[model samples]
Target: MSPNTSAGSKQHLAHSHAHEEDIPGTVNLNAAEGDDTGYGQALFPVPAEDPNDPLQWSNFKKTMILIICSFYSFLANAALIGPSPYIDLWAEEFDISPTKASELISYPNLAFGFGSLIFVPLYLKIGRRPVMLISLIIFCAGIIGASQCTTYGGLMAARVIHGFGSCVCEALPVQLVNDIFFLHERGERIGYYTVCLCLGTFASLPAGYILAGGYGWRLFFYVEFAFGAALLVLAFLFVEETSYDRKSAILMSMPATESEKASEVMGSQVLAEISETRIPPRKSFAKTLSLWGRVDNDVPFFTMMARSFTYFLVPQALWVIASFGINIGLLALAYSYTFPILITSPPYNWTVINSGLFAIAAVVGYALAVPFTSSSDRLAAYFTKRNNGIREAEMRLGVMLPAMLIGPAGIILYGVVAEKSLHWVLYFVGGALSYFAAYFYFSFTLAYAVDSYHSNTSEMLIAMNLGKQYVLPNIALILPL
Candidate 1:
């Protein structure tokens, strides 16, 4: 195992209340005799002997949930970054310097990070479904408000409101993926979520085209509002509450045969099925649609927020913070802040609409990288089988090596080409490569962190999100404004 993976795994094992997962991210992947060998391993987190456990949910249900959350990530981020090309235009309109107008995006972004401080803990308290629904409502309201605002200050306020509300869109998918999926499926599933999140940053391209098409900037927010409203409906219909508290059930059916002994993730010999107690039936659709679900009054809201500060000491958690923050600073910022300025300036004189083409390049880069989304999962599985079912969080990190090298090259290329005023294609090449690398780092490092530490997922996220947004050590907390 890589040092980082070993560290995370050791941390995971140390903190785990269950004995079965003694190795971090490690689980018995081998199926019991007569059971389907699709994953070839025992499920981790040892699903409760209850249908209501998110783990026991059918694939279709899990899939619909993933889709809803992924689209939420897309919708929230598109609105956040989509207005990038408007900096100059807004400057002209507001009778201010481009620097002042840039706050339209920057302050909203700052709010975006700050939102996680509140929402992650809120979800932990009120349950994911109600919080998600309420958040979407806030997001939609902000979008419509943005569309109607004529003053710079009014628009800024609207943007910040939506940004704060939409902030959970980033944290929820990872939380949900961990909540619903098994260890075997996490790396690949996170890939799917990561790709959508990356693509949303490209929303600037379409935003620019909308402006160029003569409907103007406000139309972009209107379009976003329509999409946000539609997503709210889909979320209500499909995104069931995933915050399940799976308690340990008494084991029942262990010795039908030696070969039939199911893998148990909890300590000691346990059966795959539960004993004695009556299992609760699955919630009905109408019940699932109810506004509220599980509420953990025990989870001290403010205390949870305060405890997040401790994760700063964890090496694995810090890696994710640095990885996300630097990528956000370097590539995302470069593309959003600098691309339009460069493309529309002296040498190229391209129209602002054409500046959005940089997003196309980012899309291409992410598309090329998307094929590798499952590579880490497959590679880790392969290595797990080799290691006698002991999977390290670092097992999937090998795939990130290529990305690490490729990402820096892309950053360097974009920077140098911009300095020399060289070919624009080279700049696009740089943007694509940087983001291509970003996808891997974003997905896998986070997976590693969660894999390393079994519980405290919400607190860990609080640390990660806040650290990335407001607390990078030497870097400016927000965007480099």
Candidate 2:
């Protein structure tokens, strides 16, 4: 057969298999008729014919965007949590209680989440690229402003501004993943983003070392400012608008069958008319760089915000929020604040600077877990194959079970060691175990949630950010008390 004929035959077969449904919360990946990316036999939410379809972009372009957004997630989170080592220093300088000083981190963390309510809807209505750019600019400005703040109030204000601005960092990366990647790729890709986000907690280690050098807390913000500025430029240059209206795309329809075509010659004419109406010409690079995207008239911004609150009722979304909150609030924040004080006390008598070294355990934990980032994706794919190409969202969640217990155990270990003044190494072991488990929970739960739900992803993200932020700060505050 001719090469064109072979290709057409394969495409037709792929289309025939595409309409088959898997169990709820799953996708069919029996791409026996299509291209295989190694993880699956087929694609879900199949690519559009337009070259501008994000899934159709070259792997290099996709990787670049992922790298940029992942880096942004890193910076935003680092800026939020990196200041933990400075709580004591700030308290001494500002003549406030340690709790008050910690509030600087806690309150800003709240803003970090609340920022999404505004930006998520704005992106849904306007475009992801523009909102990201605007947020980065605001983030850079806030960082710069923070570095110059001499007063406690001034610094807090600056932190809040940056926190709110960079808040989209949490949600945007996931949205971009949903927009650009295939279902098979989402779990692995989100794992990469989650790794970066988790690594941001390690920033406290370096932040402590910087202050130990007597460079001061403000210097940390200065460094953040520099990176934020660089990231802003990179994002503007590389992150294209991914907010396509798939409903209006012609390729969203199923392929016409030969039998249907044979029934009427006018069927072909009708298909052509539909394609013409649905597909627009791909925009040039320069046009894509334009500050504006065509506003989506169907997106109701306020209604989206209102509906986001309802996602809290979703089991998967609630799980994600709980996973993040417990990890961040009870485990991470608790350890960051307490370890310094405990270690620097008489029994341990470690240098104040060395307190942040506890984050090294976090580093080790995440580094170890990094290799398993794709485990859920692989597992889901495996289960899909066994189920005759039917994939379930629950298939990816089995990996999370081990993490669920491991995290709390580590937290308990840390508490016991701290309470008993046991060997300092026990602290590290506890932290490492907790963080290792946290990695699985963080990466897979979010992936599972996304896979399970096919609704407005941005709204779900808003709900997640809000839920975690609200729950985390209260936990952080209570733990410190």
Candidate 3:
């Protein structure tokens, strides 16, 4: 047995209580006797005694998992959006309409969202590690295939393949966070993931320069492929199987040292009990790499998909879907498509290469918002304390209020400036302001949803990814028309 498991078992035997249901907004700061992480006196989702419990893992191990998963989120998004500047280039090369070429980005984006339908349930039924590894391999294969494509059809297929493969990038990070982190830390950690995710949009700026250097668009895929391969290896080494089925109530309130009749006379009662009562021998390192995951007989595939759709009826889930969809469609895609056309036209006449420089607005905007990423968590914590340790999901929603109007206002500014042919700098000002607010909405809204509902998080993520995909394409179509 590993030292972690050994220690956890001892702790379990020592503690007097099992895990309890969490109130929506409040965290149990003190879960164990003499336990204090400085924030509270209780532990929420009381961790199991098994070393295999993700919560029982050391901080170093948890941080490594977060870093690797966050980077994957970054790469998946960068690959999806990075090729925006290449629409015109692909159009010319393939003798297709720019509209048709733009579909390369659009359709693949749909695939990116829909991919959750297949992968989420797979992870839930099988395990996170194997699914993640398989997805990474598929993503790398698609990237390599795209790098060598000679036709638009070939490229589109490759794009879809990669987009579908990497779609888990959107959901996996959030799921992993839910699995490993505590209630107080979720907001800040999710913020870190959101920052990396937002930074992916900035890839267009570098992609433009890459094209200007005469390396060709295919080189971008090649570079991403190289990174994907490296990440796969890193994941193999660091991303162990996090899918442990914890047994409930494993600790006894009092131990029985004598015969059953004597113990009964002593009035010893059970305090905890988990699913697996006996400690299993630890598997070797090689055993961790085995692709087979324990199949969850209870989680039927189609039923899980069906249940995920019900999250759409949830107000918080709906809010997250709308937030992601509007920002991605209106802010990211709309701006990417429009800036290139507008800046390179008659009055402004910016060179094609320089057109993508507008992405710097996004860079500046997200960078400014980074410090505030933990604001929601802090606000929630404060409210929880004020409420006598009872937390409400709405506690975090306040931080979003300031950013709510800012993004829409920026959109209006961009439109007016474009319509009137105003100063070029106004475009940058508008975009930066909009993206600034988008960061808060993007980060906090999702965090709020997770906090509000303690249901199957993986299923909620599926709904989130699927909802945004459907919403974005419609907006992308309507805006250009």
Question: lDDT of each model, Cα atoms only?
Answer: 0.78, 0.80, 0.80
Clashing pairs in 2: 26-391, 31-41, 31-42
Give the per-residue lDDT digits (tens) of candidate 1, residues 1-481: 1101233322111011122566555555555543323345555665654566787677788889999899899989899888987989899988889989989988888788878878998999999999999999999999999989888999899999999999998889999999988776788888899888878887877777776788789889888999999999999998888887665332431222232334444423443233212455667889888888689888889988888889999888888898888886676655666888888997989986677677777788888888887788788888888988766778888888999899999988988988999988898888888888988988888888888776888888878888877543235434454
Q: Give the lDDT ranking, best first.
A: 2, 3, 1
Q: Across residues 3-70, which tens digit of lDDT does each residue of candidate 2 receive? A: 11234323211121333354456666675544444464676665655667776665777888999999
Assess candidate 3 and give its TM-score to the true structure: 0.86
**Model 3, position 339: C-alpha lDDT score:** 89
Query: Model 3, 1-481: lDDT tens per residue?
Result: 1213334445322121323345554444433453433254344555554555676666777888899999999999999989987989999999999989999988888899888999999988888998999999999999999999999999999999999999999898898888887666788889899988888867877887888888899989989999999999999988877776655413431122123345445444431222224443345668767777656777889888889999899887898999899988878779977988999997999997788788788888888889997898788777767776666778888898878788888889999999999999999989998999999988888888887775578888999998988888788779868
Higher-scoring candidate on lDDT, 2 or 3 = 2
Off by over 4 Å in 2: 1-24, 32-38, 88-98, 251-282
Using all chains and alpha carbons, the TM-scores for the candidates as numbered come to 0.85, 0.88, 0.86
Model 1 lowest lDDT segment of ten: 9-18
lDDT of 1 at 191: 87
Best prediction by TM-score: 2
What's the C-alpha lDDT at position 273 in model 2?
62
Span of ten consecutive residues with least summed lDDT in model 2: 9-18
List the candidate numbers ranked by TM-score, top first: 2, 3, 1
